[model samples]
Target: MTDIIEAIERVNGVLVDLSLEAFENDWQRQWLVERGVEIISEASRHLPDDLKARNPEIPWQKVAGIGNVLRHNYENIAAAVLWKLAQADLSTLEKACRSELAAEQSRGRR
Candidate 1:
């Protein structure tokens, strides 16, 4: 759970600096978009199965798959798609992570 939170935080941090203009710059694409996806993927892998099941709205497998593609299919990845993910999809994931973390904290207090 802590790992997931940290991962989500890392992703959010990367996203803060990303923009569609980043696609025009190789360094930003690698460091921000690609790396952010890698972090999310790795963090998603650590999530407990039940926790993942609880958030069916998130495409957990697809999130993990992005990590795989980044790692293995780097040359084939489309900059436009990566840009879209960084700009749009990650917010949904971040919201889900924050919600789960809040729920977990509340449960711990009881």
Candidate 2:
């Protein structure tokens, strides 16, 4: 669980470092986006199957998709698409991560 939380934190840090407006259009921020996608993919790999299966609400596929785009279609990946994803999708992903972390903490308390 700590590993998962740490992964989420790492991703959040990258997003913060890149900053909102910069991430929207700056091609220089591409490396950070690539790294963030990798981090999220790695984190997804560690998630429990039960947790993933029961909670179909999470966007695990999207996280993995980022890795795919960064790895395979690096050249073809569109900045505008990435920007839209950052603006529209990241908040949902962040909330999901926080929710999972909170659930883990509550379980530990019990």
CA deviation > 4 Å runs, candidate 1: 1-19
Write the residue-wise lDDT of candidate 1 on 9-102 in tens digits: 6656665665656545666635565776787788788898998898899899999888888999888877777767766787788888888889
The Cα RMSD of model 1 versus the native structure comes to 2.3
Measured on C-alpha atoms, candidate 2 has an lDDT of 0.66
* Model 1 lDDT on a 0 to 1 scale: 0.75
* TM-score for candidate 2, residues paired by index: 0.71
Clashing pairs in 1: none
Per-model TM-score versus the true fold: 0.81, 0.71
Q: Candidate 2: where are CA atoms >4 Å away? A: 1-25
Q: 1-110, model 2: which lDDT tens digit per residue?
A: 45445655554565665655676567667566566656677677778887677557767777666777778778887766665665566666667667877888899999
Model 1 TM-score? 0.81
In TM-score terms, which candidate is top?
1
